[model samples]
Every structure is written in C-alpha cells, then in structure tokens.
Target: MTDALSPAARLALDEAFERDAARGGFAHRGAVAVIGDDALAAAARERFGSPIRLFHELTPIPVAPPEGCERHGLVPELVDGVTLVVGELPRTLAGVDEIAGLVARHADADVLVVLAAREKNLERGMNERPRDSFLEVAASRGRDKARALIASGPRPTPSPAYPRSEIVSGLDFPIAAHGAVFAGTRLDIGTRALLEVLPAQLDAAALPERPTVVDLGCGTGVLAVWTARHLPGARVIATDRSWSAVSSASRTAQLAGVADRVDTVHADAGEGIPDRSVDVVLLNPPFHDGRAVIDDMAHPLFRAAGRMLRPGGTLLTVYNSHLKHRGALERSVGPTSQVARTPKFTVTRSIAR
Candidate 1:
C-alpha cells in the first residue's frame, strides 16, 4: 500500500503496481479495482503507465461489455485481466446504487465501494430557482453522509479542487463558490440590489472608531467586502452557513487589504454570533432552498443582532418586496423602519434598545 508516499504521490502508484505484480495466479487474472480518490488514481496511473481511459461520472455498465472493448476503447487488461473503472463524482449518494451495482458487475464485487467527503457541511449549497434555507449537496455521494471520517479532527475538504467553484468576484475579495452555478457574470442581481440598497448613513453617527458590521447570510462576501471599502473605519465580520462562503469572504477581505478588519465565521446564523459586540449588521435574505419556500433564515440572524449589538445598534438588511421584515424585527429588536425599497429589494433598519 502506497499509504505513506511523500511529496510525490507516484510512490504510492509504484507500490500498488509492484504489489499487483508480486501476486500469483489470482493476480494474473487482473484484480480489477476502484479508487478512493483522485490522488490514488493519479498515483496508480504513474506506476502502471498511462493513455488511460477515464469514465465520466457514473456511466451504466455495458450490457455486453462491448465486444472487443479494447477496439472501441482500450480497457486496461492486467495480470488478473479484470477491468477497473473510476467515477467522476468523488462521492456517491442515494440512487447511485445502480451505478455501484454496475461497477461491481465490471470490477471486483466486494471491492466496489465509493469515496465520500470527510465532512457533511462542506457540502455544496444548491439553489434551483433559489427561493429559504439552502440545501447543500456534497461533492459526491457518501460525502453528504459524512462517511470518510477518521478518528478525530475536522472532516477534510476535497483537495486538488474536486469541488470546483467559479471565483466570481475580484482578487480584492475571494469568492470561491461551489454548490450552485450562475450563468451570468459577477454576483447575482438579487445580491446587487440588496448590497446597493444598504444605506451608507445607517450607522454613521452611531458607530464609534470603525464600528463592527456583519453580513449575516453573506453568500459571496460581496456585501461584506464592499461595506469594508465603503466604511473605511468599519471592522467587518462576514459569516455564512456555507463554508464555501466563509472561504470566499476571507479571500475577499484579504484582497481588499482589510483582512485585519474582517473576520469570517462558519457557524450557523441561527445559533447567533458572538454575544453583544456588533454595531451594525447587513443581510440579503434568501427566500428558499431550491423549490421549497421558507422564511426562517433571517429570524435567528435578527435575534442574534439584537443580542450582540450595543443597545442602539442597527441591523440593516435588504429583502425581497414580497417579504415583510416588520414582524421579525419588532419581535427581536423592539422596532424597525424601512430605509429604502424598490420592486425587488427593501432596505430596512432594526434598532436595538
């Protein structure tokens, strides 16, 4: 097992091939296999030599195994003579059972297993027509289930960019986003309208030396980074339920030369932020995760802001015109007022007593 290969993963490949070569009759039959991750696959290719054929995602097994398969596509034939296949999905989830069955049919049945992500939350947050709470999808199957765990520590992120994301924003602030795909360039319009609606004077007189502000459901950290630039004296804290968002926010802050004034946290906004420390809060609340419509995301954030703010602190956010922010703010922060409103977004201010 090339388990302990150093910097060059090729060492693992050499080990796997040598081990396969050493085995006898059973080995000659071409002990077919599947890999745990891309790292393992690359290593194997190094030792075995390449021009290898790669299967895309999870293709169903061929009924006839393709007569003279090598003529159609060169399937690797080894001493054991079994065919090996790898999946594009780093992890597998439900309904992939058929693919798993197909892999077993082609390779070693007992060896037919899929690799999963180390953590579940690292799952990509997907939005269909994106309407409250984001429904996240892991890079591959089993990752959604968090099966690749070791004894301790945090679950790992897929390396080598298994979970690829389009970096939408400037290097000034990082926005390595995954889970959802955007067709147009730059951040979403809903976000633009929301960020643009943020009132510059909301906390001007209220804040002390560079008042701290948080973009609670910060999707791209666009609002957070922009707030930093717009409010030079402001210390910005960006928090998102999505880890991808946190990473993006951190990078955005770094690029903006405000990393010292910016902090990104991965905790759920529902659980609340560090107690009683914020002076201003900004948000662009989402209405749903995919097709399911929900309105609970802004609740905890509203409450959190009320608890964390300094007495007369302000929770500023922009919401879709269809949503009413009055009831939520009234219950959490005593009273709320509309700062700005348009067909798509309404900028509101909640005052903490």
Candidate 2:
C-alpha cells in the first residue's frame, strides 16, 4: 500500500475503496471498478462465491486501474450503466477532438466502471514526450467497461507559469526558502486572509512551551516569520513545492532577523514535515493550479494535517468565500469552524483530534 503513491494518494485509498464498493453490490449485478478490476473481482468472488453472478470485465490495456489494480480485462457481465465520460477526462484534453469524435458516434451501455489510472504519462499528457503505452498508466487502466472507474492520476501538475529568470526579486529576501524564489512580492489573497486572522485565533496553549509553527505550503514564507515575530518563542518551519518559493521564503526569514527561528525547506507541497508533531499548521493554501479551475489541492493538505497534527492540534487555513468548503473542511478536519472572513476570503479554524 505504501508503494508509488504519495502521502495524499496513500490517505485517499480507503475513501476510494468505500466509494468503489458502494457502487458495486456485494453480489447482484456486476459493477466494474476500473482502478483495480482484478483485485475487486477476486475479492468479490471470494466473498460471494459462485452463488452470486458478478461479471467483471477488464479493459485489455496493460496499465493498472485508476482506483484499483487490473488483471487481463473486465468482464461484461458486471454492470449496468457506465457514467465516466472518457472524453471529458483530462487525459483526453489534447486529443479531445478525436476522443469527442469517437464518443459522439458511440453507443450506450449498462455497466459501472471505476477507473483511477490514466493512460497518459507526464510526457504524452504534455505532448512533448513520445507516447509509450508500456509506461503510460493513464492510457490503459480498465478501458473496456460499460461503467467503471478510469485511471486518471491525481490532478495533473500545472506547468510553472513564472520562469526562472522572472523570479529574480526573491534573491533579495534575506535568509530565503527551500530552493528560494517564489511568491515574494505583495501578499496573495490566500496568504492575506491567513495573516488577517491566524494570530488572534491561536492562544498560548495552542503552542508548546517552545512553540513550533509550520507555515505549510508557505509560498515565500510570509506567514512563517509573521508567526515567529508575533508569537515570540515560536519557531517557524516554512515550506513549499516550488523551489523558487523556498528561496524567497528563506530570504524573507533572514530579513526578519528570525532566520534561526524560522527554517524553510523544499517540500512536495505538504509532504516535507514529519508526521503528527506540529503545534499549529498555518496555510494560505494554493487556490488555483495555474489557469485551470481548481480551488484548492485539499487532498494533500487535509491528509497531511491528519498525519502531522498531534492529537488535538489544529490546522488553520484561509479560503475565498466564493469557493465555500465549510462542509468539506469540517468533514476532513475534525471539529472545524470559520475563524475569519471577508467578502472575498474566509479563514477556517479546524482542530485535528
């Protein structure tokens, strides 16, 4: 289970399983789970035996399924109406014309498909790299299904918009971030919302006798030092995915003269920290993934906090009001509530128990 998956992927597995299982009945009509067709069928068969007729169809593609593993192919006898609009998927984004052209001329079926893998790799998906079906998980996961999950990896990473040269301003930021050079200028709204209310929400007990604050996904370390200066005894750990962001945050920390107090590290978004040892986790989380429309990369932040927060520790984050995630925030984050809000942004205070 701790295979190639990131912490985010590892954590999302159970929810995926429950979603997949609920889609297919324990025995009745066959339900196709595209992610791991072979595993599901074997499990289903083992549990049901021959008394229940579950037809499992695996697509002939070689890649693993999106939500599960694939062996050989899926059986046509398992489901009754597939909802995955393959052409609507990101894997088909480039060749959408061809994909849509095919789907436009396609027929309907009664099958359930659960696909988690996408046959496209980073290269093919980007069009710069040649297509190698052998290595492309997106191209193959359970393909031939009436209704099943299609293998599309977690949201594709958007190409960095700012160039290396364009990130020049960050060089001046004192001590600097992990790789340095990112989000250094004016505070972004997400970061701003966090700045406006995070301190007031945190009390003396929230921190340890010697507090440690992680400015998670800390683009440019604005909050890292801010927390250090305001909290006095608190040590701040600033981090981000972009090397540039790390560089800049480090500089900011040095400029603040809290260089030793605040440590900036290069990390995979929220993957940098040790699990479950933090006092307060503050984030002005990313709201957009480049030009594409994604509000937040909540899966990682939520899962990472779940693993990192000491029992009863808290995760304080800011979000735009329009994207309202109060419900999702409450569900993923134990006992969550809104701490601050403006017409544009809302600060969420969640305790991780």
Candidate 3:
C-alpha cells in the first residue's frame, strides 16, 4: 500500500509471511505484534491469517485502532511471547531507537523480524540496537537493497535504554526524548538553527499581546520549552502525532520549569485548536512520508498553520534548504520572508493573510 516501501521490503515481507504461514499461522504461534497504523497491520494480516496487536506512539488519539486487535500506547512491554513484525517505515535515528527499545522491552518475544530497505542505514541499526536486548542477531544477504534481520533469545539483564535525556549546547535546558520522537534527545541542526534566531524574532516589541503559540510537530518539545522560557507572557501548546513525543515534550517542559506555561497535546497537526486563534506557529516539518523523501508532507502543515493563525500572524519554520518550501508557504499561508539560512537549513517567516 505505501509506495515508499522498497522492492527489497516487499520481498522481505513475502518471505516473513511465508515463514509464518508455513509454520502454521501467527495465531498458532501465540500473540502477534505489529507497530504503526492499519496499512502495515493489513499487510501482515493478509499473510498471517490472524488479527494483530497494534502499538501506537500515542494513546487515545484520533487514529482508529485495528479491528479486534489489542491496542497499546508507548508500551512495548505489553507485547510478549509473540513474533514482532517491523515494517521499514521510520527513517530517522529516533525511529530506529524506538524500534530497538521495543525489542529490548519485549525481550521475551519469541522472534523479532525486521523488513528493511538495505540501502538505507537500517542494516547498521538493525544489527547494533538489538544486541542490547537479544542474545543472537543475524541478517540475511541483501536482495535488491533490502534485508531481513531476525533476532531471538532475549538477554536477561541490561534494561531498555529509552526516554533518554541530554543537554544540548544551544539551549539552557536539557531535552528529554523517547525513541519515536524525531532526532531523539539530540538537537537537530535545522532545529538548532531555528532556535538561534527565535529569541530575537519572538522578542520583537511589535508582537501581539498575550500571544498563543503553537509548536506544530513538537518533537521532544524543544521549540515549545524555548518559547515558554523566552516569551514568558505567551501561552505555548506543543503537539505531535506520536504519543511518545507528546509524553517526552511534556517532560521536557516540566524539566525546563515551564509546565505551568506550556500545554502538551497528542495531536496530528494543530487539529482541535480554534480557527484564527493562534498568533505564532513554530515548525520543523518532516521531509518524509513513511520511507519516501517527499516535500508534500509539509503542505498539510502549512495549510493547518494558515487555518489557525489570525490575520498578520506569523509562522516560523526551519527545513532542509534543498526542499525549497518558499512557494508552498506563499500559497498556503501567505507571503514568505527569509529569516535565516545555513549551509543545510533554511528558516523562513510566513505571515498569515
């Protein structure tokens, strides 16, 4: 279903399914686990001949849970004595960390199999991260730049390393992150660049009174925490689709001593926020949709910002320079102006019309 899945992934999926089917269906194997939304679970169901337990980064969120499957939020321990099928979807370091954390948490799982595109850095991650939790990890030869990793024999000691915290150089407070949050605890270069310019831009005396700021896609709440610290009078809302991110953001805000000023929400975009109710929106839009590197992912975010901002409100964004989001910003929000630029990133201010 996801066109972004590489040919190698398709082959790996077929192999995994056939392996299970030959061994007599996943239902017979005990419990079955699959991460992410329905598309991936659907693919697994087609071959496994059974319902799958769905694990989501966020809980009680808008996305519907798979039918007849137990739903869990951010808890890998909920799945055990099962075969976990991981689709090659997450493309970032944080995503890899999250999956590895899941494996570590569910060390008792009968088998952990990954279908990943070999050309990506997935092989390295697959080989390394599982070693923390499993006694044996092996990989299949590459096929069409796709590979399969099978890990078993859960290690008894060494607890899961996740929800880690690190202090970044540019910020005053430490950032806490879960595996699913983008960039994990590390401050991404694009976000770091945006943070450098945010203080001056947000501090401008001409800003509206008691502004409501929304951090769209607030991975780990770096922007929200920083905004709350600098703009003391402003109300900050940090939102992300990942429940892990939402939880991590909340912790970051609290750790930064701004919990009273910031609100963390599990949401896709700024979903329930009132129309024209926000004054400023900070964004570091994701570049990929599943595994495909596409600029179209930011279009909806831009439109959401446009819908939430009042006339003359501002949307500050940082993105990969090569993405060239200027045209889309102009069309979706309003006229756009460059705020800052580095070798790899571009920061812009788009005003809502």
**Most lDDT-accurate candidate:** 3
lDDT of each: 0.49, 0.49, 0.76
Clashing pairs in 3: 57-243, 58-243
The whole-model C-alpha lDDT of candidate 3 against the native structure comes to: 0.76
Better of 1 and 3 by lDDT: 3
Which run of 10 residues does model 3 get worst, by summed lDDT? Answer: 2-11
Candidate 3, 1-353: lDDT as tens digits: 64544565566566676666665656656555666556656665665666677665644445666565666665655465466565553555556656665666663446756545556656345466666767777776778876766666666663456678889788899999887677788898888889889878886525766889999999899999998998898999998877888889998998899999999888788888999999999999999855679977888999999999999899999999999999999999999999999889999999999
Q: Higher TM-score: candidate 1 or 2? A: 1
| CA displacement after TM-score superposition, residue 9 of candidate 2 (Å) | 27
Q: Is candidate 1 or candidate 3 better by TM-score?
A: 3
Q: How many residue pairs in model 1 have overlapping backbones?
A: 24
RMSD of 1: 15.7
For residues 61-138, could you state the per-residue lDDT of candidate 2 as single tens digits?
333433332332112222123322211122222222222222222212322222232323222343321121111222
lDDT of 1 at 229: 81
**Candidate 1 displacement at residue 257 in angstroms:** 2.9
Q: Whole-model lDDT, candidate 1?
A: 0.49
The numbered model that scores best in TM-score is 3
lDDT (10s digit) by residue, model 1, range 1-353: 34532222232233334334544312334333333233444444444443233332212223122212211111122102233332222322211322332333333422222222334322342111111111221222232234321111111221122122344543344444432222111577666665655645553435787688888877657778788887888888887765445655666566667777777776667244667788887777767653456777567777777777778888876777777878888888767888777787777777888
